[model samples]
Target: MSFRQGAPWPIPPTATGKVQMKNGYHQVKYTWPAAGWRYEARWHERTPWARLITYPSWRLDRTRPGKGYGPDAAPRLTETWVGDHWLPVSRLRYAAARYNHGCATSTDIELLKAAHPAAKQKKLPGK
Candidate 1:
């Protein structure tokens, strides 16, 4: 699917080992190349009380030579996880938000189970 500005993060439908829970937040980090660009993303989420907050940051670098290249080559864009106030709503974040509101679908519940195993047993907000 297209990962546009308003679209969800590229979370695979199947289970993956990349998912994790750290410091009270669910996280997924990976890198991949697409259409001649290399991308690295660090996505994480936390549901404190009743709200789900997500930080999806990434950096994209040009892998192939292009006309837009200047004398000094550098990444096209870079966004770190820290100092992010404009939180965008990604697919993963949307799913977490739904779960927090007690309107989770099967896929959303499955994601929660994978990201936070404790959620399977406890009545957690992200679960």
Candidate 2:
């Protein structure tokens, strides 16, 4: 549950890096194999190779329609302080009520419970 000293952190591979199923996370290498050396590069950050840092390292095909994500779409990050690295959370094809941080957000007014107060606290309307 903690970072191992002396041992290097598990740096995820950018899109243009090679791939292979190791432990649980995908592994990446900077260079490709010379011939039939076994390892092969899969996904990279963006098209071509520019050696630039990108967020939320992508793998071969592990990504799914996890919330906020689908096949071949941009990834959604959860934790903060990862401006440079977008740590993937999960995928969400669709949501019933998603919290919005923008002014363009809206919600179902019908789901509102106590437009009025009850005895002690307002009772939510039964679905």
The clash numbers for all candidates, in the given order, read 2, 12
Highest lDDT model number = 1
Q: What is the TM-score of each candidate against the true structure?
A: 0.29, 0.14
Q: Mind giving the per-residue lDDT tens digits that candidate 2 earns over 3-104? A: 111112232333233344444333333323322222222222222331222221322122222245457564433321122332222221111123222222
lDDT of 1 by residue, 4-74 (tens): 22112343333122556776656554556666644444444444432432233232112332455768765
Strongest candidate by TM-score: 1
lDDT of 2: 0.25
lDDT, candidate 1, at 35 = 61
Q: Candidate 2, which segments miss by more than 4 Å at Cα?
A: 1-17, 32-127
